[model samples]
Target chain A: MENEIAMEDKNSTFVVLPAYNEATRIRPVLEDIARKGYNMVLVNDGSSDNTLEVIKQVKKEFPDKIHIFSLLINRGVGIATQTGFEAVLKFNPKYIVSMDSDGQHSADDLDEVIKPLVTGEAQAVIGVRPFKDMPKSRSFANSIMNILTRIFYRVNVSDSQTGFRAITVEALDKISINATGYLISSEFIREINDNNIPFAEVPIQTIYTPETQAKGTNVKVAFKILLQMIKHQF
Target chain B: MYLYALIFPIISIIAIIWFITRYFKGKNSLITVVLWSIFWIIVSLFAIFPNVSSAFARLFGITRGLDFVIILVFVVLFYTVLKLYFIVDKMQNEINTLVKELALKNEISLDDEEE
Candidate 1:
């Protein structure tokens, strides 16, 4: 299923969802995004599960409302997202909002995230989640990442790990990343900060399920992120 | 160890030969070949005359020749690491492009089939 109207709308806002194994969880989220009439781009990162089928089913329902892309293999979240960004930029969209497909990000808060861009308040808007409500361990790691980013790169963002973000065409054009892993979050902040892009944040509710809460940033992943940051410095 | 000095010359000889052959075969750029050639020459020199590093070290007010060689090795490794990082970064970008194009083409072709 393909959406002919995917990029034709000059004034339309796009929501790009990079899916992994979100087969069951994202079915309803896709429905909600489609129900809201937002242009959708679903990127399946080579899920072994039935994610591709779920997206295929959703696309069949809203052929004119969404575009679905599945990578031939599993490239991590960063690579999938970069694919989505590159995919949407071809249409010359005015505003592009990216969210995770794991149902952590709300389709309803889509409006608020993109509002800053729509109103010309900020060229880039990050969907900041309340860390206090999160699990202690994951929240602490995220907070350390935020602090490290500010200390090392001189960029201040509340939620450095938040996947939900709204960026204008100009801001998206300035964003270039070389990470194939999770450090794309840090790369995004560095790109915006380096280019002096106007950045803003809006509070968004993060609905964490049991699975979401359990998927914490372990030591291995955290070390990789730190190594990527240090590697990128060179 | 004194034995490390001998190994450095052996490794340097191999590197020099490899780089020269690669340059002539058009596998490496002329600049890279020349740079590697100079680097190996310095390594072989220091390896053969361990006291040379000490003299050089004394000029910079350092203590021992082995310390000087170790410092040089660290610098070379650091430079190599940075260069390799850039190559890896470029490969990542290429992968992103390849994946993006493949996904888009697949989606478009499927849509065309439906039409």
Candidate 2:
């Protein structure tokens, strides 16, 4: 299994993380992924905090392993993540993985999250968590979004909100991420479903803290996502 | 009333003169100048001869000329508004494309890490 993985890593691959004002939480997250020896791209989404300063420190330590793109303005998660893709495409990487910068997603799940793709079982892989302890309003909102995804996009993944996802270069080159906001999660599913790209999910753990909870899923933002989903119904 | 009659003709004349100057200065397109000229001419004619609108209304079997004029005004406004919306949307899309291209160009590759 180890030898098989070395051969897979020989191909161009990268992990992209979208961060916004996560100056304090990003250190452990980047360090964990770097220790795993994966080429990474950290796209700072115009963070007002010392996030870019921290990113600069990481780049200094692992200059050859990590690439950075500091967006001059806060565009949103969709565009920031898209910028990550644009940067990774320059290296002609075959597999591109996207993860969060809030330290919620673990680097340990990277192998399993990309497992289905490694075995040729699926073109895309996403992380899933039960969220049994998830707050009431947040869980209810996720349930509503999950149902809407199934009803419209025909995607039945256990978790659609997880940012930890892997996709093939084929999927990336074909689908365009133009939503320009947080709606990219559902928009991502919509594209995969409409393009008939096979996908699977691996169960993963989510470590929530007061910081993560403070950045809750907002109702107004969710409404905007719904409107965009309806407008661009796949 | 005489005041009502003179008011529209005066406004129509001013608009027509303004449009002509704009067209000559290249601030307005030829089609725009022609369209507005025709619109103001008709307005001034209707104001000068109020019976013509009623006559045309009678010919078309409409209830009243004022109603027909009001309906025409709304239809033109709606059509122009829709056209403006498309123009603005196209401009916005163009700007987004340029931003993407420039952002990609400005990307810092790991190979070129600062020394």
Candidate 3:
């Protein structure tokens, strides 16, 4: 498996990291991924911190392996991720994987997440995190969102809100993302169902530092997502 | 006869005048000025003669003129809110597209510079 992955990592996979206000935590994540030899597309979502500087420094270190873009203003994660997808697609990679930049998604899981796409078993793969390992508030919100996604989109998945997922270039070409916020996760599932794309789910490690825990969706955001879902249904 | 009846018509007349002035100044569209002027005129007429509103309410199967007014206000408010939501949503999507395009263009220019 190691040899096979190493051979495939020769520019066949591009990892996308969409970041917002993650200046302090993004360096280690980027370095970890860079050390693994996979190409990266980093979208610095108009972060209010020095995240762009950090990204540029990292780009200098791995100039051949990284492509960076910065939105002039902070659009939400959805648009940022979509922009990353558009940027990476031009490179003609076999697969594209999107992961959070706050270090919640471990780089070690990158190979496992991309394996199904390589093996012809699935067109997309979702890196599922164990709810039992999450904080109570996040777990509760995730559970509710999971149920709502199942109900609204008719797609069943254990983790509907996971930021770590991989898609084939073929599947990526078939779908267009419209949501501009965190609700983009649900929109992905909707696109999968609508396009009849094959998908798989794999368990992945999630590291929840205080910073990561403090940056995700809250009750108000969840409510807005729900409203957006309803609006999309019609 | 009542103080409210006298005050409301005066306020409505002022609103009507303001709407017409805005239209003349090119700050408001013709449709907007017409609609607002009609609305204020109705309010003035309703305040001066409450019976007319009651008659209008009966046409809508509402029992009281005040209840009809409340319902009308809510419907208008809801319509305005929905319209504004769509406008903002469209503007946001456009901005996202513009920003994405610029970012992509920047990436291409950077690649050129590196070469």
Fnat of the models, one by one?
0.48, 0.30, 0.55
Model 1 chain A is weakest, by summed lDDT over 10 consecutive residues, at: A1-10
**Collision pairs in model 2:** none
lDDT by residue (tens digit), candidate 1, B1-115: 5886789888988998898899889998988988888888888888777778899889878899889879888988999999998898788777777876799777642466468
The better-scoring model by lDDT among 1 and 2 is 1
TM-scores of the candidates are 0.72, 0.78, 0.89
True-structure RMSD for candidate 2: 4.2
Instruction: Judge candidate 2 against the unseen true structure and give its global Cα lDDT, from 0 to 1.
Output: 0.79
Question: TM-score of predicted model 3?
Answer: 0.89
Residue ranges of candidate 3 with Cα displaced over 4 Å: B1-31, B108-115
Off by over 4 Å in 1: A1-11, A214-218, B1-93, B108-115
User: Which residue pairs collide, candidate 1?
Assistant: none
DockQ of 2: 0.29
TM-score of chain A of 1: 0.92
RMSD of each: 5.6, 4.2, 2.9
lDDT tens per residue, model 3, A1-234: 445576555478999898899989999999999887789999989999999888887888888788888899999999999999999977889899999999999988988888888889999989999999999888898989999999999989999999999999999999989888989998898898799999999999999989999877666677888999998889
lDDT of 2 by residue, A1-234 (tens): 324555446345699988899999998898887777778888888789999888878877877677888777677888889889888988778788998889888888887777787778999887886668677776777777777778767888777666788998888887877867777887788788778889888888887888876663556666777787787754
For model 2, residues B1-115, the per-residue Cα lDDT tens digits are 6776898989998998999899999998989988988888777777888777777677778778887677668878998899898898687656555655666677655445544
Q: Pick by DockQ: which candidate is best?
A: 3
Q: Please state the CAPRI-style docking class of candidate 2.
A: acceptable
In angstroms, how far off is B47's CA in candidate 3? Answer: 3.5
Task: Report model 2's interface C-alpha RMSD after superposition on the true interface residues.
Answer: 2.7
* Docking quality (DockQ) for each candidate: 0.33, 0.29, 0.50
